[model samples]
Target chain A: MQFHTLFSKAVPLLWYGSHVDKCEKLTRAPGGTRLCEASSIVVYKSSLLQILRLVACEVWDHLLHFVTLLTHRIIPCLDVKAGRVVKGVNFLGLRDAGDPVEIARQYDEAGADELVFLDITASHEKRDIVYDMVRKVAEQCFMPFTVGGGIRTIDDVTALVQAGAEKVSINTAAVVTPEIVRQTAQRFGRCATVVNIDPKRVPRDGFEERRAEREKQGLFAPHAVIPDGQPDDIVFEIHVHGGRTPTGIDAIAWAQYIVELGAGEIVLTSMDADGVKTGYDLVITGGVSSAIDVPVVASGGCGSPEHIRQVLTETDADAALAASIFHYGEYSIQETKQYLHEHGVPVRLTH
Target chain B: MIGIIDYGMGNLRSVQKAFESLGSQATILTTPDMIDAQVSHLVLPGVGAFGDGMTHLRDRGWIDPINDFYKSGKPMLGICLGMQLLMDSSEEDAPSRDQPIPGLGMVKGTVMLFAGDAYGPGKLKVPHMGWNSLNIQQDVSLFADAPENPHVYFVHGYYCSPADSNVIIATTDYGSPFCSSLKQDNLWATQFHPEKSQRVGLKMLENFAAC
Candidate 1:
């Protein structure tokens, strides 16, 4: 019999953390309690079996509350140049969006789970301006927001936190000095430290050709192989300095490394899909999300609420960050969350 | 005036700013001398390891003053790690599995890390970072004017299990119904950050300020 026949007759008992794909893999089960040999899924629809499933799911629900109760966070990012919110396509061509504080207040009222402010034009003299902007946002906005960009030292992290940023994200600085992440975590705790990873997909063939030429020139060893089975015949390479410079580091491996160094959260953005607003790069997002223990915020290329739902449901990402959709007033935070909640993704809906 | 204790763990400004937003003058008590008679309400705000918190309090000579303030019968509140510090001991930073580190003993309880294998194969992540609903158990002024089952922001790995159940005002289920907040006489504590919890949290702060 087809699996759809079983589905039509009986409901698959989905407890907490049970994926739909995992449920669809079920082939057969002799009884409700017994697991099928092929897919190891137990399916049952009898009244007594349904009661048992309910009781079991309830028991597991309480047991798994620590993991299951964490609602997916919807973070609206503000890429600020000096003090005003700015938008850029693929990290260039800056256009003024709005006042950072006003946009932050709107998101706060709209019940956004969190907010992110990145100083796109991170400069030395602009540090004071960022600090002032952070302080203003902190005073007006009640929710947690992370400030990133040009966070080069521990003092910068301290300044931002003191200015009311619950967490400080390190992007280029984290890539330059990995010790900064460890130091920040050690000093202020892991929850206060966030590492942002902007990864762009590179053609595997061209990358391999460059590597071979460099290796023949004795610049480096040839053993730095791209891991097997990368999706779409491409490997994600880490980019720094507002996605202007590319580092030869593997994005997934770098994520694991940063996690090891005690980054509380990882904001993974796909430069290839950013600003286009089609959808998130689920392949790399899922890749890094699965490879690490810390919460990964899948960012970039979120055009619609369905995209948000897809990334949250498909990938194990704990949060989704979008700028264009929210900044442009295409959708309110409440509407997006309503869409997510309706689509079976658990989100905190503020009335 | 509200005094927020700063032992150099986490951001105390947000808490102060939260109180300030509610038309209350709040101060970050950096030194032990700052915790004095003029301070009406005391807030012990912390985020980090239990041992580190205890060490900071002891090293900074805040242990005695904080205890004295608690004994003063004035309203006191604790947030996140501050809630854990009210306990007698904690499993975190313990010398051994059996020998837990000593807390302030202001409240009778023990803090334990969420065990990884409590729920079979898929273990839960630590630092339970996000907003979760509070299953308010007992009536308290802190939750006065707040909505039923209001969600609050929490970001911690360990949970407080007070030996005295009477002190537990609200119990949240984030895997087995751990103590989320407690109110005993003049002292109140919560495992969540009221400062970052949006409106519901601000209301709780307002109620505490009123107290």
Candidate 2:
């Protein structure tokens, strides 16, 4: 947390106004880290006032280095696509954000609890995970990092783990082959294994009940009805392939099964509220968190610090994952943490 | 040079890099014979099941040498599973058909897993992953420059309960206050990962290097 010491003596430009002799007044700022004061020589020119304003900005910039704070955590997710970070609206219309390694470094410096690198890049060829990208980030940063997106076999897990990934997330493979989660937990230990569940909220109000009656009358098909016939509070349904394909599996049930199989953590993303920047799906997040004993990271929609605070405080989820707010630089990890700290939520202050 | 013992575990490289970040020379000593005259301080860095870790140590002939290194009276530090391996025995391997896996017995303690039932329903998460503040039970030089109530990163299931309370250097509360760090003579171990704990962690490591 080094602040660049400035020793500037700029020559004043004199043209028309009368001025007295140069008078410099030195004053100390808060925390006594540095002397940030102004020399008022009673210059009449407005442009000279501009120099004073610039100096004030510089002083304020150094103020960020003075404060040391701590508490919970604010994690920013970097969905990597083709070596570049990207964000999509509801897992579609992918747009480029920044470089993965560069964004990772920024988050590390900003004091994120953990960084999750989702290798969203897909290709025709069966290539290994972005190992080189993970390796570079691991070498440069010293925070807990989790790598996910298309980790299938034990060899894939081994490669990523050896490349400095603290945890490997399983999503589609956990559904296609449930035993892989147990196998990975057996090899890398449960703490290093995670399951990312992307679920879409099912519409309530007996819609499925009506659809089931229609299907029974041969109006559509046997599998056309929703799983529970639209129960009043049927939470959410699991969706795979970037939340496009719906599996009749209940999101809460799947979370419990995955935990039973040895997933130490669960990352639940709400497809309904994702990319909308409203807030996390607290109902599902809290439901799944309370249902399982492991730490649940709430993912999907987090627009502001208040949104994060709400999920963390209102729900029993251990952590909250934000993408849009952090990606567009609306608020930094430090600012979000400050909001949480002021709101009486315990979070790590000094990075 | 700090010898980071690599008994076929994860994050061993991370520990080495952390030491290097502080301008300290740390080398990953793989074999038992490698930890000889050149090694200044010995560090055991590990992550995984206790039974599997001890098995790797025993099969690779690291058990006797690690004991010999501890006997050498040189400063030694163990992190996570490395800390658990310092106990006399561990219940983590009790379910196995073979006899219970024994530890190095450097400290009179047994490693036990945190039972999910004891903490009541949904009270505590297993693995206790993430940062936890250290309630320093006994003050030492390790946290000299670190902030008060230093929060270090941890990710593990089992914790060591030493028979002798005097050896406990610090404790962290997940559902209950458990021994998070302890020091006995030349041996010091922590259940947390100082390498990943950011600034305060870096300071603690720097203090260990100075010690």
Candidate 3:
């Protein structure tokens, strides 16, 4: 997720002092229902524009609508590998936390609105999910939780829901068989299926040699560079298995496809922004969000409260997902919410 | 005293911790002599391929000790793969591929791969991950405080279909209703991982400990 680093310095006056009319209008939908009542909306707008231009519009809209009708959400993600919580830079150098249940408890107590547990090894290991971990976490967690990683079958989704998870997130399996989405949504409710897409900017042929060198050194591949004379310069594509294989499919196209296939929500994680804490890739979030009507979760790079504020305010994302910064206690959920609230962002403050 | 029989296949530490959580001391015993000397209650935990699990048990001379433990009329709990080992034979391993390697024979069934269309052709992925509600078949001590449809964590593709359904203590459905938990006399087994299962799972351990 590529985030705008300039957002912190560009704090708007509307963020600090809320205009009563703007605040009320923000809380009320254009149709006059409560903001929360408009959780689902019909898509009436669709147009293709230059990538940079589209991103700029999204950022501007996100800022103008910062906290009006749409409320911000807090989601805690669990990266499960070998039945344990593992984290590394750009999906490499995995280190084990004590146990998934322990980590889940810590996040649950820290005021997380929802939790995501990704079975990072499910695909590579060709194994079933770690039910032991899911069962342990589900029994105690009160908030809605999503389980991802190794979900390959409808039975897997059934078992996850039965075990207590509220939703299931699919990536590799969904891409391999799109029907899985329709089948799962039909079996379980549509609201229970979340599709997570890991995407990276495909580098151009000229930069291939440089990209190969960077990849060899375990660095992120450079964004595809456009030839000096070419009109179309960069194309964003989906990356699978921790950004190792490039699908060459446009992120917006895939998002629309999955949503049509019955995905209730989409989680767009930027390979470049992931783990950097710099910010979310608003460019991608905006593009996908504009294409689909379902809730879009902006993931990957989320560093400071200001970054979150920027994404929630600027893009059409319904929620923002952060891992390292929140996991390490760099900032609290309350602080993040407070910061957003003080700014023009609408938030539900707990008494 | 509780003795966790180690055949070098499954996870025993979490089970040991679960027992300890219930305020009981459990020992992981690897040898038959150790089983003969100190074991008052026995727990056989196994993972990986079923045939490999049984081979390790037999190679370690745990076959007779486990059978003896059953004959001794002591409480014995079989978990996941260990539960499969309690059956007559398993199709998971090759040598015993078609041949039926003898099990504890306490339960009359064979461990077979789930064959059904609910998962679709090559579609229903194996290693049935996540949790499922255990449908109580017959009232058993292991489910003392467990709810009517208590969700238990499961992680295997193969399940034991006991010849006599009367012995099935609990059943769960993924594609079909299969044995989720089993109990007959002092012999008890569960296909789900209770140790890894949270509150209800711990409650199950407490029930087993009390038993």
Candidate 4:
């Protein structure tokens, strides 16, 4: 039995070592590599006697895996319309999911790393309703939450933060003012500031054939263009006011600019992938994630756990934000996390 | 009742709500006088720059009253910037001043920025945001009956480095092993927000209430 235990423990060490290259992005933070090195050495020395028996591998792998698992965050987004959690496809065709507070509580119990509430139809008079809803949601759950939609000024950010939001995501306001992002970050620290980027792939010459190729490649369906190796004469143009208006700005370049302007994190959502669930826009997601030093959350186009695994492993995104999959009771957060773990995409599973 | 010191920074409501959920009444103390005879425990909850934090605390006339409360031998808890405020000084906003801003000096340590000279850049994220596992180094009252290596929510650019390693009850690795929680006499402090950490965090707050 002891030999069997040792063998089981020793085997995963080799597996972990072979997969170390995949974990390079996990150590993006400064001095992170040194910490990994120092800890492994300490673990080695502490179990020196077990080295010949190959028994310390489990301990080393466990510690290192815990560190790397922090890289990927699974966020469940609640698109709120008049206080109810609503679901929409391609940023339109809204359907009721459930009560905002109730859904938030459910997500909390399901081990969602964070929760996002976007007031889809936010207006001046109805601001109080959103505040009350945010406070209620905050009261029920104990995880970090972000509130976005119609967040125009520092006052909006402050109100949400005061109402129990850890981070306030700015979308339309960020495009209109641009300085609000910097101001919010300066006041509440960069970590509390998040910028949501909604971009649609601009149609170019021969767009139909290219989109068909993408559909064949299995990224998306119904004429969704996924960028290939070549530039392919496509630009991801930014959209605002809940995807109703186009902003003529490039998504990748806008992401880079906002990060420089003190946006600590970016939530990149593909307008085309809003409810498709085929997968995240890997090409653009990867582009924005690599272009910026800050963390990027790949939002939209998450149908199955496989889609999540693909985005996390294939792209540089630090997290995956989904709405429809979790909203419709298709799969619980635990199942998704379990799937990711089995597929070698590290995620924190809390019981 | 637990007294949460609100010196014009941080989300004190969440801390208060966490305690309320745990069947404890947490009152937000705006003024030093608000830390009256009814308050049994003191919670210093804050976020933002260390220099700004100190300035606000001093401006609100919280220094002397807080020190007095500490001397009263009651359980005092600090969260995030509130934890940093307990230290001797901080490197945040140091360049603008001739000398580093002084903390409460209840503990001997200095607050250092993650991207500052110590950890340098590109190794770790500036603000060690999100959930991380806590490496419990000592069996303390704050973490009594706690699960092994419980993950907690953390959001801060600066971390507290206590002069005495003995005070460190837990250490969480973010680029390197930085102090995540510390305990000294009646004072218990954590760099992570127990309020936002979900079940494990709620349990910690329950433990703190019990203490």
Best by lDDT: 1
Off by over 4 Å in 3: A1-351, B95-102, B116-118, B121-123
What clash count does candidate 4 reach? 6
The regions of model 2 sitting more than 4 angstroms off are A1-71, A87-97, A124-129, A203-235, B96-100
The ten-residue window of minimal lDDT in model 4 chain B covers B116-125
Candidate 4 — which residues are off by over 4 angstroms? A1-71, A88-97, A203-232, B96-99, B116-123
CAPRI-style class, candidate 4 = acceptable
lDDT of 1 by residue, A1-351 (tens): 224322322332233343434343332323455433345444544333544554575455443533355678999888888777767322122233367877776677779898988887656777888999988888887888899988888898888877778789999888778899999888777887799999888876755665566457654323222433355567687788878786666688788888789898899999999989999988788878867767789999999999998898667688999988877678878899998876556678762
lDDT of 4 by residue, A1-351 (tens): 125323433454456443343233333323322433553242223333434333344454344443432546899888887777666322112232457776666677879999888887656778878888888878777788989987878898989888877788999888778899999888887888899999887755444554455457663223223343436577677788878776656677678788888898899999988878899988788777766767788998999888898787666677899987876668878899888766666567773
Tens-digit lDDT track of model 2 for A190-254:
99999999978765434355445545765422222223224555547777889987665667777
Candidate 3 per-residue lDDT, tens place, A272-315, comes to 88978789987778777756756678899999989987787656
What are the C-alpha RMSDs, in order, of all predicted structures? 7.3, 16.2, 15.4, 10.3
Model 1 per-residue lDDT tens digits across residues B153-202? 88887899999999999987665678999998899999998888999899
Q: After superposition, how far is residue B160 of candidate 4 from its true place, in Å?
A: 1.4
Q: How is the predicted docking of candidate 3 categorized under the CAPRI scheme?
A: incorrect
Chain A TM-score, cand. 3 = 0.71
* Model 4 agreement with the true structure over B20-77: per-residue lDDT tens digits: 9999988988889998889999999987778888989999999999999999999999
Give the Cα RMSD of candidate 4.
10.3
Who is ahead in DockQ, 1 or 3? 1
Query: TM-score of predicted model 3?
Result: 0.50
* Pick by DockQ: 1 or 2, better one: 1
